[model samples]
Target: MFTSRMFAAGAAGFALAAMGPAGTAHALHSDTFAADNAESAAVVSAQIADTGSLDGDCTGTAIAPHWVLTARHCIEPFPTPGGSVRLGQGDQQRRVQVDHWEAAPAGDIALLHTVEDMGLASYPTVSDTVPGLGAARLYGWSPDGSGKTTKLPVAEGEITELLDMSLFEGKQMINVDTHNGGKTQPGDSGGPLFVDGKVVGTLSASLGDDKDGMSDVAAYAVVAEQYDWVMETISGGGQGADAGTPGRGDLNAAWLVGGGGGVLVAIGASVVVLRGRGKSDAG
Candidate 1:
């Protein structure tokens, strides 16, 4: 209900030299295996929904029951006529229609508006431009060594530096190590990067495709930098556009920016309640 669509049409323009088309990232590494089902709750497969069945080339996170965050490039031919976000697992899964989407004017990020509640718990986010250097983890439902997508997997590595890309020139990205012991394969686009038990970035592209669509250098749309746009959209009243929701009341943006130690007072936004990963820093 956040306005018929509060954001402007078309994606933000960015630098071509920054894009380079080199560092596009993908799915999971061959070694990655099934992760806990709890981890898969908030993650969803962004697939073609016109058909009854769901299959995805990319993934997204449910920032709210009625909204999803993904890569703009994932839904090419912008303003996709039809698509759906399938969340949860098995017979208990929920598939919601993808009505409208607004792309981040400058970066590879895009926000998909769902016609129904996603039926999944929303993930909490941060407002930091950079997620202080340390260990960061990636989560996605990419194929494993045998090309099997049995379950979602979690990848761990040190967040080395803030990468710069032509596609997202003005944006700051969190770079994770992929060559040595971890990396992302094809179909992993739009995954989430966690730091301090909060979402800090959305998996974008990567550098150097090893013929199979895997890469060592991956770039993510930093969550902190894009936080304002997200809160604003939800604040515009994401209930039903006509639900008569106010614009910006108790978004708890301040508490989110202060990190997750205080009790949140949910207002018009999704109440984010995530169990800590048992680490003070990204693991």
Candidate 2:
């Protein structure tokens, strides 16, 4: 949860720039759909229950009708079922439902299944090839979790680097960086970063100090190369296709306790298991 001060401080500059009557109207209009109009814009949200309370955040996108791509860590498995997904939701909180979820822990990516069958019509199309130094935009609900209603804020940045092929712990990954200092915060993980209105990368990690300021770093994630696996998992089967089912060794109690951050250790194995479920059971 970001502090009110953080939200105020981050949004103040932009707010001030939009002062006065004309600015107010422009601000309202921009807040409505200006961000969604971009080729690289997508919406992602989640529902999680911790400490006996159901609370969650929004940060993700629709790469395919029934498929939404997000960060591995964002998928927090719950001891009990009842999690849900909201897509294309704007300030009003209106959204489409995603009925399923799957993830590849090795790639740090998650795919969402829509309940109502969202046609592949609105998804961003990615090229089989990677773009060099391409520009992109990012969108997500920047919740002012400081006791106020969550507000979705949008930011834009350029891709400074795109490592479509890299090895991490022996598993392949896609690394990326943006010119805009904008990044994924605690609730912003699993959002989508768009290029030319097409799905490019999932918002995974960022380089910075933690809330405690102990760890300073940069963040990245797996990209399009894993599309086949993602497709397979969403379509049902590739590797751990039985992940969603109970009693599987992969579906352990540790997932609920650790959330997405703790599952990094067995990402490779988890990816295989997660794909079987077709949706990350993690909150």
Candidate 3:
């Protein structure tokens, strides 16, 4: 099942520790205001449920006025109805209802529509440039259920080795290292990894023995390579807003290192990851 990590592990700390060699330790987590804090906080605080009860915390990003990007498994029906995506981290008053959801079951990506238009202070866009071998930051929420409120915090890290295309079956994924002892957990799936203010990838999976401390092995869904597909889906047709701007990184090289003969799962686009067992539900 898709589950959220607790605060005991320090969401930010776990992410940093798992970042491995390429990541750098930074004080970003201690900053008063985080990158995209207002929006991310809203998403972290919002309640998510698939059936009569809560299923798990789902992380999301504002790609457009009304669309949120998340993992397809979070909303997939598994003998039960899926949960909904909530925006606005700390503001309890701003709750937007989901109007609809679209996902490529084979790719593990999903887009959500809200009842009202949401104005983003900062919207994450794909950059044609990829960061060199170094640490960067990935932001999202960690659900601890410690008190009446849940918080989504931003964490920093560095870019590890960019995997090859063969690492993934279809979609693009990159490995990263975190700093400040932070890491991604189950609920962080679909979050955005920003480098120099540009979004390079989406949080997909992490390597960890337990729920607290995430392992050094972490992967993200590359957005640049999928810009065409994302634009096509978001635009409604071949003629909508253009979200296909490329980043600076070499996607072809990254793919060759990340993707090889990895296991390919059908979820929206084909998500290729290292062979493993724990196939948790997307939610």
Better of 1 and 2 by TM-score: 1
Which candidate, 2 or 3, has the higher TM-score? 3
Q: For residues 229-250, write the lDDT of model 1, one tens digit per residue.
A: 6666655533332132223334
TM-score of 3: 0.62
Clashes (candidate 2):
28
Q: Which sections of candidate 2 miss by over 4 Å?
A: 1-42, 48-55, 76-81, 89-92, 95-99, 119-121, 145-151, 162-183, 210-218, 235-283
> What's the lDDT for candidate 1?
0.50
Per-residue accuracy of model 2 over 67-111 as CA lDDT, tens digit each: 556665445444432345544433544445544566564565766
Cα misplacement distance, residue 279 of candidate 3 (Å): 18
Please tell me which predicted candidate would have the highest lDDT against the true structure: 1
Give per-residue lDDT, candidate 1, residue 184: 58
Clashes of each: 21, 28, 67
Q: Which should have the higher lDDT, number 1 or number 2?
A: 1
Model 3 CA RMSD to the hidden true structure, in angstroms: 11.1
- What is residue 174's positional error in candidate 2, in angstroms? 6.0
Q: Ranking by lDDT, best first?
A: 1, 3, 2
User: 1-283 in candidate 3: lDDT tens per residue?
Assistant: 1122212122221111121111111111223224444334324321233331232345567665556665554454333323445555455425566656665534445566665666555455545545567766666543422111234466667777775532224345577876655544444566677776566666666534343334435567666656656655555532223244223232222221100011223222222222111123222
